[model samples]
Target: MDNVISVRDLRVLDGKKTLVGPVTFELAPGTTTGLCGPSGAGKSTVLRALVDLLPHGLTRDGHLEVQGRPIRYGKGDSGLRSKVVLVPQTPVVFGGSILDNAVFGLRHLVRASREDLRGRVEQALKEAGLWKEVHNRLDTPAQSLSAGQRQRLCLARALALEPAALLLDEPTSALDERSRDTVEESVAALRGSRTVLLVSHDPAQVERLCCRTVRLEHPETMALTSTAA
Candidate 1:
C-alpha cells in the first residue's frame, strides 16, 4: 500500500519550549495507525500539525508530505485539509437538522444538486454507522442526538468529503461504554477502504482497531534546534 501521509522529525514548539515531537511515522493507504501516548505527549498536537491547525503561539518544523506531495505550510492550506480531514475529540453540532449537519461541509466543498447532496450524506451516514439510527430523523434537530451520535455525525460530515485520509483524534474518548463500542465498529469497518491515523491513550482500543501503532513519549529534555530529516 502507498503512504498517504509521511512525517519525519516532526516537532511542535511553544515559544522557546519543546512541547512535542521530533517524532516520525508514515500512514499507508487503507490502514489504520494509532498514535498512542500518555497525556501531554503531543499526540493531539501532532494531529493539528498535519492539517496546519496548531494552536496559537505554537509552531512546528518537520517534513510533512500528504499523498506523496510536500505540504507547504503557512499557506492556509484548506484544500489540503479537505483531502486529509481531521475529526477532533469533541463532537461539535451546529444549529440545524441532522441532514444539515451531515451536508454542512460537503455543500461548500462540493457542488451538486440537492438530491445528489442528500445521496452523498446518506452514504456517509451509513459509513459512520449512523444511518440506521438517524435515517428516519434526518430532518430532526441535530441537538437531539446523543453524544456518540453527534461524534458519528461529525465523522459522517468528514466522510462526505471523501478524504484520502482521516485523522481521528480520540474518537471514543468522550463516549460512554455503549457509545464507544458503536463508534469502534464504525471505525473498524473502514479498515481496508480508508487510510486513518487514530490518536488514543487506550492501548486496547488501538490494538483492536489499528493495524499498526506508533508510540510517542513525552520529551525528557527540550531541544533548542530541530532537523527536517
Candidate 2:
C-alpha cells in the first residue's frame, strides 16, 4: 500500500487525561478508514492528535509522518489543518457569508489567483452537493443556513484545501436523515483518491463506507478490522 500517513505508538494527553493511544495505524492513499468507538473514547482526540490540534493544554507523542517526512513544528511540516483537514461533529459554520466561509481556506494558496479562488470555491460548493441552494445567497450569513446546509458548507471548507486527507469526527451526529445522506454521498464520492478517516457511532454508515475499521475500546482495547464480508 502506498501509505499517505503513518502513525506509530501515537499518544495524546490533555492535562492529566490520556485522550488517545498508544495507538498506531497507516492511511493508504485511495482508502477510507473508520475510527469506531463510543463517546469519550477519544475518537475525536485521535483525529485531533493527527492534526496536532488536541485542544487546550494537550500534547502528542510518538512518530507521525505525512507524505514521507517528519512533521516538524512551525515551518509548515506540522500544519495538519492544511494537509489533514478535520470536520468536527455538528455543523460548524464560520462567521461569514456562505461564499466567504467556503472560500476561507483557499485564500492561503499563494499560487491561486483571486478569480481562481472564487471559481474553485464555487466548484467545491457544487461538489459538496450544496451549490444551488446557496449560490444565489452566497452573501448571506453562513449561520443562517439549515443544519444540513451548514454541514455541507463545512465540507466545502475542508475541500477548499484539496487536502491530502480528511478526518471526520462524528460528522453525521446532528443531521437529519436526508442531510445525513447528502453528507454520506459526498463522502462516498471521495473514496479511492481522497483518503478519509472517520469516527462514527452509526454501524450502518460504517458498514457502507469504510474500507477498514479500527475500534478503540476505552483506553486500552484496540482492534483493527478489515472490510471483509
Q: Report residue 81 deviation for candidate 2 (angstroms).
A: 1.8
Per-candidate TM-scores read 0.93, 0.90
Lowest-sum lDDT 10-residue window in model 2: 72-81
Deviation of model 2 at 49, angstroms: 0.8
Query: Candidate 1 — worst ten consecutive residues by lDDT sum?
Result: 220-229
Per-prediction RMSD in angstroms?
A: 4.7, 2.3
Model 1 off-target regions past 4 Å? 220-229
Q: Can you give the lDDT of residue 175 in candidate 2?
A: 84
How well is each residue in 34-99 modelled by candidate 2, as lDDT tens digits? 998877778888988788766778887788788877775324453567888988897677787888
Candidate 1's residue-wise lDDT over 83-130, tens digit each?
999999999899989999999998888989999999999999999999
